[model samples]
Target chain A: MFKLIESDAPQRRRICEIFVDGEPCQAMIGEPLAAALLKANCVPMRYTPVSGAPRAPLCMMGVCFECLVEVDGTPNVQACATPVREGMHVRLIHGARSIGQLGGAAQ
Target chain B: MSTFDVVVIGAGPSGITAALTAANRGLRTALIDEQLSPGGQIYRNVDAVDNGMQTILGPEYLHGRTLTTRLQHSTVTRIQGASVWQISDDLEIAYLQAGVSKTLSARHLILATGAMERPSPMPGWTLPGVMNAGAAQIMMKTAAAVPSGDVVLVGDGPLLLLVGKQLLDAGASIKGLIQTSPIAQAGKAMRHLPKALLAPGYLIKGLRLLTHLRAGRVPFFRTDEAVNILGSDRVRGVSFIHKGQRIELTVDTVLLHHGVIPNVQITRMLRLEHRWDVDQQTWKPCCDGHGRSSNPSITICGDGAGIAGALAAEASGAIAGLDACFALGNLSEGERQKLVRRPARAHRRQLRIRPFLDTLYRAPEWLSAPLDETVVCRCEEVTAGQIREMARLGCKGPNQTKFFSRSGMGPCQGRMCGLTVSSILAAENGVSIEETGYYRIRPPLKPIPLLALSQARVARSAGTERNSQPNEDPTHE
Candidate 1:
C-alpha cells in the first residue's frame, strides 16, 4: 500500500505557527510538531517531581512516555510519540522536580 | 574481535539449542548470553530470599528445568550478562558486560533473543503505576514482589489471564479482569477441543481463573479499553471506556498489556533477512524448515521467529538443533530425517492455536494510535506528528524515519518502540503493517565494555598470535 509520490518542495513549504511557552514557533507544512521543537532545541519535555529532573525522549515509538509535553494547555502529550500540527501549542509540565520529588502533590 | 566457527547469541531455548548442536558436531562455539543464567527472559530464575521455595510452573518451570540442565551439559562456552551492541559482517560482536567492553567473533552465528511485551500506548499511559503485564510477571518470577493493593489486570491475551491467576496465587488482590476480545476466537481455533483438551491446559487455567474471579464476585469488564491512567506520581486509578462510556475504577495498580513482539535485535544485527507477521505485531527472521536464515552460516529459532509459546519454542529448538547438527556434518541422513519430522508435526499442532489468537486479540484499531502531539520516540523525544510530517516530506520508510527523525535511534535501540513506529509508518502511507518491516537489528546482541573485551581477546590470542602472525614469524623472512 506504499506509494512514492513526488511532492512540490516549494508548495510543501506551507508555513504554520505553533506556540511553545507563549512563544510563536514557525514550522513547515506537513512536518511533525516534535521535529520543529527538537530543531529549535526546546527540550526538557517534562519535569519530574522530586529532583525536578527534565526528561526528554526515552523510547521514541511511544512505548515510553519520557518525551511527554503539554500540548494546547493539556498536560502529558507524548511529544516524541505525537505528530506535529500546523498551529499546535505545547507547554512543559513544571510542577514535579525529580524521581525523588514523586511523593509530594503537584506543587 | 575473536572469531570462532559458530557464535550462539542468547542463552535462551534457540541459542542454547543451536550452540549445543553446533559444538557437539565439533564447530568451535561461542555462546553469548545476557543473563547470569542461560534461561531467557520468560524463564528467568527467581533469586531466593531465604529457604522459602519459589514455586514455578508453565514455561518458567518447564523450559527452565530442561534447558538450564542441558546448557550445563553442553560443550558451548557460555558468556553471561553480555549486552550485545552491534554485529559486523565478519560475525564479530561488540558488547558490554559488568561495566566492561568486549568483542567476539564467529563464522556461523545463531540468534534466539526471544520476545517482550508490545507496549500499546494510550492517554495517561505515562503514569508511574502503569506497567506492562510481562514486566509484572517478570517481577513476580524474579523478585517475588506484587503490585501492592487492589490491582486491575487489563487486556485479553492468554498471558494476561494466566498472570491474573499467578497474581491471585501470589496473594495479590485482583479487582477485575478486562478482556478486550471475545473467547469464541479461542474456542474456534481449538476444533479438536475434546481430544487435546489437556495439552492446551493454559486455556483451562485461564477459564479456571475466570471462573474463580466470577464466583468470587470479582468484577470483570470485557470488550473494554483502558482510556487513561490517572495519577500524578503513582497510579491512583484507571478509566475504562467501555462502549463509548468512561467508567473510572479505583485501583492503585494498572497492569496493561497487549501481546508480545519478537526480540530480533541480534538476528537483525546479523543482517538476517526477515518477514513481517501482521498478526503478531513483530518481525521474524526468515527461516526455512530447518531454521536456517538467509545467511546460511546463521540460524534462528524460538520466539525470535514467532510467538508460539514455550513448548513450540522447545520443539522448534530441537528441530533447529538437529539441523545445526546436519550443517556441522554430525548427523546421518536417517537421524536428521527422524528428528526433524516429529517436531514439524508438533509445530503444526501449535500453529492451530495461533489463528484463534490472531482473530481474538486483533490489535484493536483504536489501539492503532493516531498521529498526535505525543512523542513517538521517547529516546529522542520525537513526536508522531513529526514523523508523519516527515513521511509526507519523503521519510517514507522506518529506516528513513530513523535517519530523518531519529525515531528508532536510541539506547534500548528500537526494542521498546520499533513495532509501534513501523505500524504508524504503515498506517501513514496506507500500507499494511506487514509492508513496514521492523527496524534492522545489529549485534554484539548485548552491550559490552571495550577494555574487558579487548583484554579477553588479547588473553586468548597471546600464544597463538606469535605462532600465526606473519610479521612475528622469523621463518617467513
Candidate 2:
C-alpha cells in the first residue's frame, strides 16, 4: 500500500514584531510576518482613527494598498507586498490627521 | 464622429503592422492602445534617453522599430493610454484617454487588440507580491521596476521559460522554474515542435534559455505542483508536491503564468463572431482567408485571434492590413494576396507549433484546480469549497459564481480567476473550457478609481480648451 505521510514542512505560520500602535516592533525572520502580528493579537497596524476604516492586505497584487504600514519612516508601504528584510524597522501610521479624509472615488 | 479610412485598435504586433501597411498605402489611419507609448504589451519601452527610446520588446519583435519609426512619420495618428471601452457593429468606438471619453467612427476597423495573460488561480494570487507574467514584464520593461529580488517562476509553455531568463537579466534571481507537466508529457508535445522551430531563430532562442539554465546552474523542477502559496500579507514562500513528496521553498515573489489568452473583450462587446480555441485557451474573432471578420467592417489578426506569439501576430496583422487596403479600394485582391503570401506562411507555421506547445503544457488539470480548502480568489478569500457549493446551488457560470461566491468579483475583477472558475464549472458540468467563455471586462479597464475617471474627463476638456497641438503620439518622430 503506497501511503502518503505528513511531511515536516509547515504550510502556514507567522513571524512576530511587524508593527503596533504606529511604532516599529521587532519581527521574527523566516516566518509568516502577518500571522505573527495577528498571534500577538494587535488590534490594528493602521486605522483611520476617526472614520476608523480598518484596512488590511486585500487583493495582494499591490493593486489595493490595504495593508500599508510605514516602513523605515516611509508611509503607505504595502505590508503584504513588501518582504521583511533583516533589521528592517516597521512603523504604523495612524490618526485622522495622518490619514486625511478622502471621500468615495468619483465613479 | 471623425471618420477614417481605417482604424487599427491595439498597437501590438498585429495593430502596428495593420497601421503601418495601411498608412503607407495612403489611407487615413489611426492606431490606438492603452500604454503611454507605442509597442503594445510585447515590445514595451520605459524611459526615453534620446529619441532612440531604448525598447525592451522581445527579439522577434525588435524589428518593429523600422515600422514604428515609419508610422511615426506617416499620416497615421498613434493615440496612447487610450482605453477603447466599446466597439459597435457599425464600427463606432467609445474610448477614453488623458481623462476624457470620446467617440470615434471608422469605415474599416481592425481589432488587433492582441492576447492577454491567461487567468491563473492560486491561494495567494491576489496578494501583493504576486503578478501575471505580462504584468511582471510591464513592470520591468515599462516601469523600470522589479517586483522582487528573489522570485519563483511557475506554470508551463514558452513565456514561463522566456520570461524567467528575462527576469534574470533584469536583476532578479529566479529561484527555480516549476513546470506542471512531467517530462514524459513534454516528449508527447515534441511532435508539434516543428511549427515553433520553423522560423530561423525560434528554436535557437528556446535552446538558448535551456542552455543558460544549464550553464548558469539554474534549478528547474519538472513534474511538480505548487500546492499552496504561503503568506498572510505578502508572498513569503510556495509549497509544492514534487513526485509525491512535499517540499516548501521560501521566496519573496511568485510569478504565475499559464501562457497567453486572446485580448478579446472589446471583440466580444461588439458581438463579433468568435470561436473558442481549445489548445491555446483563448477566443479568436472568426475570420476568413483575407482576415475579414463577421462584422465585415471589423477584421482581426495576430494572437488576439490565437496565441502564436509575436511573429505570427505580425503576419496576421499584415494580412489584416492588406485586407483593409483591399476594402478601401486602394489595392486589388491579387495584389493584396501577393503582399500577404509571406505572412500567411508564417501564420500557418505558428498554428503548427501550437499543438506541440499545448500538449507540452496541458496544465495537469489539478494545477488550475485545488482541493476544497485551497483558496482561489485570494482577494475575497473565496475557496474552492465555496465555489463548489455555489455551483451546486445553481451558480451556472462565472458571472453567477461572481455574483454568489464573489469568485471573479474583486478589485482585479475576473482577470485572475475567471478562467479557473470557468474551468471548474465546465468540469463540474462535464463540458469543455471553451464553451465556458472568459470574464466580462468593462470601461476603465485597468481598475481606475471613479475619482480618476471624473478627473480624466476634466483633463480632457481642459486640454481641448487650451487648444494645443495634441502630443498623444509619443511614438512619432
TM-score of every prediction relative to native: 0.73, 0.75
Displacement of residue B270 (Cα, Å) in model 2 is 1.6
Which window of ten consecutive residues has the lowest lDDT sum in model 2 chain A? A1-10
lDDT of 2 at B16: 89
Off by over 4 Å in 2: A1-107, B46-61, B194-197, B377-381, B434-477
Across residues B26-92, which tens digit of lDDT does each residue of candidate 1 receive?
7778888766666776666522211121442344454465777777887778898666665655455
Query: Which regions of candidate 1 are displaced past 4 Å?
Result: A1-107, B1-4, B23-27, B46-53, B56-63, B182-202, B215-217, B224-226, B332-334, B371-374, B434-437, B440-477
List DockQ for all candidates: 0.02, 0.05
Model 1: how far is B138 from its true place, Å?
A: 1.2
CAPRI quality level assigned to candidate 1 from its DockQ score: incorrect
